[model samples]
Target: KALQFQEAKEKRQKTLAALDTMMKGKDEEAIKKLLEQKQQEEAELQERLGEASQKKQAELMSLREQKEEVMRRIHVVEAILIILCVAFSCSKRRLECNSDKNFDRASSLFTSTN
Candidate 1:
């Protein structure tokens, strides 16, 4: 009976050792899965960052083009305004010269009548 008890005790110790090894393997697998998940999340974040960068660059280019277009329009308006000012100045000078000639003719006619 003592030998049987000794054999049973040895078997229990062997079983406990096997269980410990299995638990360690399971722990390693869990750690590996967590690492893979973390890597996947990081890759997704990188992809999103790249997309956002591209979108912002496109928006910046579009805004630059719009600004250039607006500047061109402003330059065109300024040229038109300059041309109109020059035309109006010439017309005013012509009107002043004609008025002076009419006044001289009237003065001569009045002296002859007197």
Candidate 2:
């Protein structure tokens, strides 16, 4: 009976050791899988960042073009206003010249008739 008890105890120790080794192997596999998933997530995040940056750059370029167009329009309007001012000044000078000539001709005719 003593010998049987010793053999059973040895068998139980061996079984426990095997179970512990299997659990350790499973833990290592789980850790490796988790690391791989984290790396994949990082890669995807980088790709998304690149896409967003490109989109923003395009939007900035479009805004710059619109700004340039608005500036050109402002310059055109300024040129038109300057032309209108010059035309108005010239017309006023011509009218004053015509009035002076008429007054001089009327005085000469009155002196000649007297």
Highest TM-score against the true fold, candidate: 1
lDDT of 1 by residue, 1-114 (tens): 999999999999999999999999999999999999999999999999999999999999999999987776665565555445545655767555555454455445444434
Candidate 2 worst ten-residue window by lDDT: 105-114
TM-score of 1: 0.71
Model 2 TM-score is 0.65
- Candidate 1 regions exceeding 4 Å error are 94-114
Best by lDDT: 1
Which portions of model 2 miss their true places by more than 4 Å?
91-114
What digit string (tens of lDDT, one per residue) describes model 2 on residues 1-114?
A: 999999999999999999999999999999999999999999999999999999999999999999987776665555555445445655767555555454455445444434
lDDT of each: 0.75, 0.74
**Residue 29 of model 2, lDDT score:** 93
